[model samples]
Structures are given as structure tokens and as C-alpha cells.
Target chain A: MARLITWCYKNHWMTLTLLFAPLLLHGQVNCLIYDAASGERIACELSLRAIQYRQGSRNSQLLFDKAIEVGPKFAWAYYEKSVPFFKRGLLAEGVSLINKAIDLEPKNYLYYRAYWYFYNRSYAHCIEDLEELYTVHHESFTNTPGGEMEMRMILAMAYAQSGEVEKGIEWAQHLMDTYKEQPHLKGQYDHHILGVLYYLNNRPLMAAAQLEKQLEVNARLADTHYYLGLINRENTNSTLAQLHFKKAWAKLQGEGGGHSPNIFEGFNVSAQDIEGML
Target chain B: MRPVSYLPLIILLLTFSTFACLQSQANHQPKYKIPIVTHDLSYIPFDPLLDDPNFQICDSTKISSGRNRLQYAAGRNTLRSDIVSRFSPQSAYESFNGYIVIRFLANCKGQTGRYRAASLHLDFSPAQAPSNLEQHAKEVVMGLNNWSRATETNANAEYSKFINLKIKNGKIDHVVL
Candidate 1:
């Protein structure tokens, strides 16, 4: 013991550094993070962001797969892998992966969001997940800007789709009013979505008004023109309908054209309606 | 040699063994290394919200998957360059402008086949029309076979894409896909 003390004293700086190394190293570590598999976790997050931005779903899938291979116990990897599958229209594979994710971590609210809200398109199930996250846990997704608004939008859409049009309108109206003056928050509030909700409520005039308001903001969209055309056609205004439809077709041939058919547009207006009626 | 003389050697061996054991234990323990993120700017994806006009449904507006859009854009740019090299500006009326619309199926394998060209419209208003401008445009378009292959996530599905070329003053003005 005396000899050891003498040696430490002789090399005090080195000894001190050795003694404090573990403390300094571990200080920045997040307790919530899986310390054993941080590399995989980072790769997983990068892959998720890439896929979300449409960077390359196939590459993202491979990255997710690699993450899972490295950290087999990571529940988020399975959840993320399911996203690419869903994007690719492989619903069965996506559902299976989501189920696995939920099974691995039953407490994860995002797993439920992916399965119920995004994949199933069941408003009730989506609402249940949101309610559970907001009421019971309140630990997920409340910190980000517009997170609360997004929750409200989902709930409003859910209510509208579930035959509670009045409740849905209440939420939708609140959203629109809140973001009305904040034109920069266009990423959050969508007039087309609000217009669709009004249409679902069987108020065609109100729907047209909402969509026209969007056009006033920006009229460069062919989809909006086509939608207005459909609304006018429904109102039996052949002249306005034809005008909008012709404009839509002309815009479709413009510089930024060749977009996919709107899934929602298929609900009221068919491709035949555009080609034939126009 | 005296027995005490071997004690120093024994202590040195013990010290070495201890260090080996400590390293092995460290190898088995959980290591938390900070992650490093490197962004590659070359593979940036297209933002569809700019084109789709439906910013609210941004996720659904994704017509093409991932790097395919970037590749498609690159291909269209190449097509414009190709047309510029082939199309003879002197053959058309001075300052003449027109558009040629062509539709083709880009199959799952990223191969284009069975191209169907639409009727060519010449917009030489006050300027006299060239006799064989339509034929020249058709030949130029039909000669194009070099294209960047599109990647589709859905198994064995074909995608049909339209290529619109705006020709002005006997040179390709813009190529829209």
C-alpha cells in the first residue's frame, strides 16, 4: 500500500485522469438510450428521416434491416421497417412487422400509431391511440411545435369519418382559426383537408368556399382546379365546371405536371370524369 | 538462484494476467459510443409538395419513391441536352416555339418500350411554317433511348410517365416529366 501510494504520487496527473475517466465519459450518456446499441439507434433514426423525406424507401428499408440485425432487441427498428413496407403498399408485411414491434414494446405509443392510424385508416383506433398517449402517458410528441395541432387534426378527422360531423367541424374550425393569420404555418393547416371535411359534412358551398380560399393563397395546383371543377359539376354549373376542368388539364400539361391521381379525388371524381367531362 | 529472486518475476506475470482479465471484462460490457452523422448532399430527394399543390397531404403526394425522382430529373435534363444536339434550329422558322408530347411505359425493370407519340402542334404564328418540321420532331424524339431507370418499390409494377419537350428557336427549351 505504501509503494502504491508512492507510485500514484509520482504520477499524480495520470492517476487523477484515470480515476475520473469513467465519470467524464458516462456523464453525457442518456439514461433512456440503449447504451449497448447506440450506433444501431442512430442509423435507425437517420433511415427514418430519409424515408420520411422520400430519399429512397428501398435504401431506408435496408438500413432499418441492418439496424435490426445489429440490435435484435430494438423495438423501433421493427416499427421503422414497417413504414417502408406500408409505403410500398405491402400492407400484410407492414402489419406483421408492426405487430412484432408492439409485442416487443407494448408501452410504445408510436407502434399503435403506425398500426391503427396510418395503416388501418380506422379513425376510432387512431383516436384511441391519441387519447391514450395524451391522457395516460403524455410523454410522447407533446414537445414539438404543431404537435398538439396535429393531434387535434387527427382527432377532428377521426370524428368526421366516424359520423360525428358536428364534433369534427368544431375541431377543424378551431384549427383553421388558430392558424388562419399565420400564413407561414401553411405546413400545418391545409385548406384542401378542411374543404374535404366540409364536403363530408354535405355542405358543398362551404366546401367550395374553403377550397377557393386555398386557391386565393396559391392557384398553381391542377388538383385544386380539378377539385373545384368537380364541386361545380356537382352544383350543375356546366360552364364553370368546364372552365375549371379545362384549366386543370392545361395545368396538367404545364412544367410541374404528371402528378399521381389523388386518392381522395377518386372518392367523388373519377379519371373518366376529368377526361370525358373536360 | 535464491527463492526471493523469483518473486519479482511472479509479480510481473500476475500484473500482466490482471490486465488481460480487465480487458476481457471490458470487451463483454456495454460500450456507449457517440454516433457520428455524415450527410451526403448528392442524393437529395425531390419535395413533392412543391409540385402537388397539396401541402397538407404531403406524405400521400409522393408519386415516385426515393432517389427515383432525382434520377428521373437527371434523365429529363439529359433528354433536353440530347434534343438540343439533334434538333436543327435552322430548319424551323426563326424564333419558332412549339411543344411535343410523348408517352411511354417505364416497366418494372426500368426499361421504356412501346412509345406512343401524340400529334405534334407547331406554334409558328406569324412566321412561315417549316414543311417537314413535324417529321423532324418525330424523328428526334423517336431516336431517344437513353434514360435513367426508375426504381419502383412495389413488386413487378410498371409506371407510365409523360415527357413534354418545349422547343424554341430550333433548340430544346425545357423538358418536363
Candidate 2:
């Protein structure tokens, strides 16, 4: 009986060790470098920016690929890969990659943002993604007032573009009104919304004011000049209109600017004509 | 006689324990001596008159899983060389909504080299798939493979290894060497 007890003890010990072996053997896989101040993962953020800015899609793609290769389970890499695809008109691939990202990191806001941008482009599609982003990450924007303002401006634009012109106007007005009182938002009003609203309301003067302000703040804002040019042309200010038009054309040159004939028609401009002006 | 029988059993137990300890130690062993390489470039220039404003440099080396730090030195020269090689004057300012392929060689140990290819796919997110996504991917891979193979065949070549490359959308998201 004593020998039997000893044998059982030995077996029990071996079983315990075997069961815990894998857990103990698991090593730290990788370390991500991040900005300590922002608590933003440096590599992931840069990857996102690369995709967002369309700086080097090829390089960004490689970086994300490398990121995933190094950490197959990392959700951000998949999310990063989706952006360039979506921007370059590869919607299906973008959606698939974004879904993968959401699956891997269900709680991440970045994944949701990617999806939001996707559906926001077409109003008849998934509006829920935008709502989800607004609800889940409502607080993140509040912390960064500038970022919040920018996001609100984008959301307003998306709403307007999606054909919810009334709702878009409402959001835009809300952004302008809410931030108007704050000193921080003094110069950063909802110019896109303001421009769109003035245009929609048939107030060309107001629309031009808002858009011209946007251009002044950032000359590289090609879309602003494009819209301003449209308004200026409608107002019959040919020289100023031409200037704005020329700027838009210069900014959009060689970017497949006229690929979407539907969107370009509204501008009443042609790529060839714009090139001629340049 | 029974005590003598227990001797072999003890020996067997001790030997098994030693082997297990060695295996665990090997598995947890740290890589203490990894080779390091540094690349430096002066500048990456962009011609606003001819180059897309959105163009930026990417370091393909950073995509590796090894403990090597890769960086691209950004300035006028580097940018000019890269853009000049990849684009034409007529198409220089064209916004490319496609991927580019980059290849690198991995030198392992003292006298061995391995070729690696990475693919970049660029596109917007959260929508239905784009029409040209697949074709772009195929072209990127083909370009990388062609370049790597061609480089490998040339003697006294700048690049001696062949790495397979692929791109999906406009980004390079996969690499296999």
C-alpha cells in the first residue's frame, strides 16, 4: 500500500509539470516602439499615417506585412493594410482586411474608424459603422479638441456626401456653434460644412467665404479650392474663379483626378482644361 | 537484489530529468549575438512640379523580423533617385494608386545570403473590393520577382539575391524570400 501511494504521488507530480509546461515556456514574442508621450504605438501609428496620407502605399504595405509577419496576431497591422486598399478603390479587399482586424482586436477604435470611412462614402450602405464609432469612441475625441474638431468636420462632410444633407448640415452647424465659443476652435471652424451648407442653401457668398478661409488656413487643401472655384465660377468672378480652379487642377494633377466622372461633372471642369490652365 | 534494481530506475529518472532540463534551457536560450547592419542615405528629393505631393520614402528593411534596425534617410538626393527610377516625367506627378515592390538580401552567418521579397498594397478601407486590386497585386509580385531574378544573374551586380515580391491594392503587405 505504501509503495502504491508513492507511485501515485510520482505520477501526479509528472502530470502537473506536463500540464503547466507550455504556459511556462511561452516567451515574450515582440516589443513595439511607441511615443511615450502620446502612448501611441510608433510603428502602428506611422503605418496608419502612411496609409492615410497615401505617402508610400508600397512601403506601407510592406511595413504592415512585416508587422503582421512579426506578430501574426497583431490586429493593427491588418487594420493598417485596409486603409490604402480602400483609398485606392480596392473596397472588397479593404473590407475583408478590416473585418480580420476587428476579429483580432474587437475593442480597437481604429478598426471601427476604417469601417466607418468605408460606409460613410456611400450613404445607402452601412451607416451603423459610423454610429458605432461615435458611440464607442465619443470620449477619445473630447480629449483632443483639435482632433475632435477635425473628426467632426470629416463626419459632417461624410454626412453631406452620403446624401443626408439635412443631417449633415445639422452636424456641421453643431460643430461650428459648439466650438465657436471656445477659443481653441477660433480659426478651426467647420469650413467644409460651412462651405457645403452655403452651397446647398444657394448662398454663394457665404460658401466662398468659408471655403476661402479654409484655403487660407492650409493652401494644400485642394478640395477647398475645388469647391471655392465652383462657387466663384457660379458667381461669375472669372479671374478669381480661375485662380481657385487652377489651384485645384494643380493639386489634383496626375492623381486620377477625373477618374470619377460623376464627381468631376459637378465641378464643371475637365482635366484637360485644368492642365491647359497650368 | 531489489535495492540493485532500484539503482537502474534511479539512473533512468536522473537521465530523463537532465534531458528535460537541457531541452527547456535550449528552448529558452537568448540570442545574444545577432549581426547588425546600418544603411545611410543623404536625401530623398521630390519635384513638386513633377512628383506627387503624397510621395514618401519607405524602409523595406524595417519589415524584417530580425533584430536589425532599418531606416531611410530622407532628403533631396534619395527622393530624386527613387522617383527618377520609378516614374517618368509625364507620369511623375501622377498619383499612383498602386503598390511598389522592394527586394532585400539577408546575410546569415558568415558566407550565406538569402533573398527576401516584400509586397505593398495600398487602398482605402471599409468598402467593397476595388476592381483593380487583384491585378495590382499580381503586377507587383511579378515586378519584384523579375527584378530579383535579373539581379541574381548579373555578375558584379549591386544586388546578388532574389527575393519574391507581391503587392495587394497599392501597398506592399507580403514578403517571402
Candidate 3:
């Protein structure tokens, strides 16, 4: 090695010229992983983390641009960045990013889950992702208490949305049973999801029961009253329906009125619904 | 002749009374109150057209992500709730629905300022405009600190943000970002 270095030192100008010639001609400084589109290197973990910090701003989009510039192959960055775009109502951009993320990491169930729900709106795809995540790749994701509960909720919703009522009911029941032991964990959203699932699955009695459970937990939600009114109306109980509707109306119009923040994307419960009933 | 003398004295008294009334009228001036919307400008000054596309961080050509967008909506709702909770208007009369639109400047550093009411279309049961609610909205907007700033090249670049608060009856229905 020493003899070779000594020999190269005598021909340093030639070597320098050869290196400069290619760089000048190609207009490319060779990055280990170059992205032709962005004329930059691929992203790494650090780049992805940087993007996450700035995720709160519109500038985060540009940081995503920069992340892709540094590490185009970093699938997580694409997934992380897609969420903000979707929240901002840029569905197309979000869809494209999630797709790229999934394509790069096809086995990543979280990416698929995001893609199906946020980008494609296909419940079947969501079911597929959830099943694969739970059964095939259970060890991959961090299964904290909150994370596990959220996963179950997602699975339940996916099944319900995909017309698999029985499976949806089973999962929702599983969720209820699991959390029932811990009273503090049984939140309004849990009942809301179960109630919604039962309603969509043609189980009115069960739906009403679950919705009523929400009231027991906390009666502040305008949604609970509105939904109860809807269920009563379906049962042809005009007086009961009217009562619930009035409650909901009061809650919405009165000083202490408010709705649950835990809302699903496609499931809409609005004040307009109450107005239409009245 | 005595009656004629009394008529002169009465005429003089009437003239004095008229002059006193005119003087009082001149002294009493109508007081007009101009409402003020408070705001903080510690980072950058606000621009008139904060939501201009050329200077916006999230412009028409691009979009915000789903999570960030959701968070922004939630933040705006919280602000609305804070204002409404602090000064809730009465809602006993009839059904009502409308909105209040506010425009403000948010720079790249996430600081907000120069909050102005774009429009206020609130209707209540008693049929009086809720000046308190409107003021609270303005105060909330002005009180808002570091927001995610626009990434536009201009250092003083501001993103124009609009918060449309929908009210049903006297309660807050929802907020549109």
C-alpha cells in the first residue's frame, strides 16, 4: 500500500484530472445512493426523525422533500410525511406518499394500514393489513396497552366497514371484554365504536345498549343523544326519539354543549342530522 | 298695565330656559365605542393578506398531511371552546346556525398576530349579536402563540389562516379550518 501511494503521488495531477473530468461531465457528485429525480442522496433514520419534529408545519412538507432528497429509500419518512398531507386535506399527495412507503416496505403492515384507510378508503385492504399485522407479523410492532387497544379498534372498524358484521362484533366484544377489567381504560370512544359497529351491522338493540353505555360513562357528548334519537326513531318510538333529539339540540345550542373528539373519518354525526329530524 | 309688565317678565324667563336647554344639549356628546381585537407580535409582524398563496407555507398547489391537518383542526376547536366557555351566550329562544370568520397572520416560527374579524354572522334566540363571543374569538386568535410558520422564503412571510366557527343555537357547533 505504501509503494502504491508513493507511485500515485507522482501522478497526482493525472488522477485529479480524471476525477474532475467525470464530475464536470455528469454534473453529479457520486452519493452512495443517488436519487435521479431530486438530484440528491437517499434518506436515513436521522432524516426521518428531523422530518417528524417539523411535522407540525407546512414547512414539514419541504422537509419531507429534503428527506426524500437524502434518503429516497427510507420508507418510514414517506409514511410519516403522508399523514400531515392527508390531515391538511391533500388526499392525493398523501395517497401517493403512502403508496411509495408501502411499495418500498411491502411487509410493513402499518404502512399498508395507513394506505388502505387514508389513501384508498378500502376496508378490505384495511382488514388485510390488520390480519397480517396481528397474525403474521405480531412481533414487529410495539404492542403497548394503548397501541394494542387502538389496533383492536382499527380491526373492528375494518371488519364492520367491509360488511363482515359477525367478525366486527366479535372483535368489538373482544375489545370490550379486554378493557372491562380496567374501568379507567373503558372510554367513551370504545363504546362509540361498538355502538357504531352494531348499528351498521343491523343490530339495533345491541347498538342502543352500547350507546346507552356511553351515556353512563359521561353524558356530556351531544353525539350520544343524537345517536340515541336516531335509534329511537328507527324503532318507531316517536316520543322517545323527540326526547333524545331535544337533548342533543340543547347540548349543541346550550352553553355546556359539545361533541366527542374521537371521530372516525367516514362516520359523520352532525348537528344537521338533528335539524333534519326536528 | 300690571298684566303687560308680567308678560315681559314671563318672556324673559322663557328665553333663559331655552338658552339653558341648548347649552345642555351641546355639552352632552354621544360616546362611540370602537371594538379592539388584541394580538401578540413577538416574532414577526402580521400582513394584511396573510393567506396569500405566494407567501403561504401550505399553498393551493400543495396540501397538509392528515395528522397535521387533524391537529390544526383540534387546536382551532380548543381555541373556540376556550373562548365560548369563558363567555357563553344565552340560547333559550330558538334554533340558530351561522358562523364567525377570523383572518390572521402566522409566520414560519409559529408565532401568530394581527387577528382581524373577516366576518361575524352569529344569530341567537334573543336576536342580539353576541359581541362578547366575537370579542372572545378575536382574543383567542390574538392570544395564540407559536403556530407552525409558513416556509416561504420571505423572513416576514406569513400564512393567512381562517377560522370559521359554526354556531347552532347558542352552543358552538364546530369549527372549520
CAPRI-style docking class of model 1 based on DockQ: incorrect
| Lowest lDDT block of 10, candidate 1 chain B | B32-41
Per-residue lDDT over B1-177 for candidate 2, one digit per residue giving the tens place of the 0 to 100 score: 544558888999999999999999989933111111122111123346533454343433222221112212342224223433442223321333333322233222111122222222232221222444433433332333212222133322222222212223233322222
**Model 1 over residues B69-142: C-alpha lDDT tens digits?**
32443444466667668877675444555545444444445444434333232310112335555556656766
In candidate 2, what are the lDDT values of residues A75-194, reduced to their tens digit?
666665665444323344555667666656544533244333433233323334445545564522321111223344455555665666667666667666765565344333356447
lDDT of each residue in B77-170, candidate 3, tens digit only = 4654655665445554124344444555454444444565533332100123354555555665556553543234445443545555555665
What are the per-residue Cα lDDT tens digits for candidate 3 across A16-109?
A: 5455443322121234454444423445434444455545353455555577766666666666666544443333345566666666665552
List the lowest-lDDT window of 10 residues for candidate 3 chain A.
Answer: A139-148
lDDT of 2 at B45: 34
Each model's lDDT comes to 0.52, 0.43, 0.54
For candidate 2, the per-residue lDDT at B15 reads 100
Candidate 3: chain B TM-score equals: 0.42
Clashing pairs in 1: none
Order of the predicted models by DockQ, top scorer first: 2, 3, 1
Residue A237 of model 2 has an lDDT of 82
